[model samples]
Target: MANKIISQRISPHLWFEHQAEEAAKFYTSIFPNSSIGRISHYTEAGHEIHGMPAGSVLTVEFTLDGQTFIALNGGPLFKFNEAISFLVNCQTQEEIDYYWDKLRAGGDPKADQCGWLKDKFGLSWQVAPVQIAEMLVDKDQERLSRVMNAVFRMKKLDLKAIEAAYGEPVGAK
Candidate 1:
């Protein structure tokens, strides 16, 4: 007999210090088509090692914009950094602004650069225009250089500015 695999194909797991539920709720609220899933609570049997009271939330399964994620209340032994980030591909400047403003609330100001931001929980996010990817991979080197320069000088990506750089020269200003 073969064991049945009962799990998401690949879900990003987030570790937090007793705030997994709160963060999950906040994330689900911000992204459309998102919601909190089954929440698992700690049991008294593992209190000695886990150090958490019985009945407390241990893990929360949630969906953000259709992506599966499991938030674990695993204490503060670990912290989120820029090593891994969620890249949100925005189709318009409006979408960029919306996500940037919402996710940047209580975020680190220093991390707000190159379309990247660290949220209050220290999770990094990249709010970028979808067109930028298409432009960067374009065969035109002149356009690539212009887009690169424009992106370097930006915090939240502006679709119009990037598209403008696609045809203009480097120093055209």
Candidate 2:
């Protein structure tokens, strides 16, 4: 068991204020290839030091799009911030919209801009279409500026608009 635990590669560990399981379930439900893994609860032996009820959920191991994560129900000494975020690369506008909507449910409207949103759990996620990076890397400075300007003005990214800004030529709004 120790060898198996040590063999796994580096993965993100999230801290939640007693919502490890709830957050895990919410995340697994949103992403197609995600699921909750092992759930370990605190034992009576640690109650005096941890201050948590014995048998309460202590940790939850979960997967999001096959990437492993560990969520700990540590007390609210820390928080999820914009400094760290999950970037979801999408191929189509539909994919972009799907993730944006689901992740943004009960999200912080003030924190949303340039494809970034903070979920109810206060975790930031960048939901961007893959094409945006390709567009930004174009040698054409004018086209790059267009896409950047369009992206900078929006909360959730609009792939079609960015494409239009990349010289697709569309009717004026």
Candidate 3:
């Protein structure tokens, strides 16, 4: 065992069968102020996996919300599922709608209220508005009930209905 290992303070590692570049581009585009760094590969690193194809971009580094992700093309022995998810604190109904529409292009959506949906790449995302926290945790049971009911009845969130249910103006204080 090597005594010196790389730093582990900042970055997530993502493994893909062959869509490393594609996924990196997709994620960087979806999130604001994000970008992908240089990508490279190794032909023979020794041991059993040696003589692997070179120039295939074995790794990639990208940033989303200033967080880094390293994508590796390690073949199809594994995959991504609902076990992990990224949450976006969307501000406008349009923002939530935008993500819901774009990310769900070839993915799936589950049951209501939680904003739990899968993106085209099988990655899960929580597309929610900033107001949901307040509505869910509100001391007024009636308001919370109304909000939950309103949420269950729709595919995409109807901000107006939620606000109406809450008896508060849209984007309330």
Judged by TM-score, which candidate is best?
1
**45 in model 3: Cα distance from truth in Å?**
1.6
In the range 1-173, model 2's lDDT, one tens digit per residue, is 21135235798999998999999999999987887878888988867677888889998888888788889998888899899999999988899899999999998999999999999999999999887776777777998798899999999998888888888532221
* 2 or 3, greater by TM-score: 2
Best candidate (score: lDDT): 2
Q: Residues 20-92, candidate 3, lDDT per residue (tens digit)?
A: 8899888888778787876777665642663347666787777776677788888887788878887878889
Task: Estimate the Cα RMSD of every predicted model relative to the unseen true structure.
Answer: 4.9, 4.2, 4.9
Local distance difference test, each candidate: 0.86, 0.87, 0.75
Q: What does the lDDT come to for candidate 2?
A: 0.87
Q: lDDT tens string, model 1, 1-173?
A: 01322276888989998999999988988999887888889999878788988999998888888788989999878999899999999878899999999999998989988899999889999999877767777777887898899999998888788888887533344
| Candidate 2 segments whose C-alpha is farther than 4 A from its true place | 1-7, 168-173
Pitting candidate 1 against candidate 3, the one with the higher TM-score is 1
How well does model 3 score by local distance difference test?
Answer: 0.75
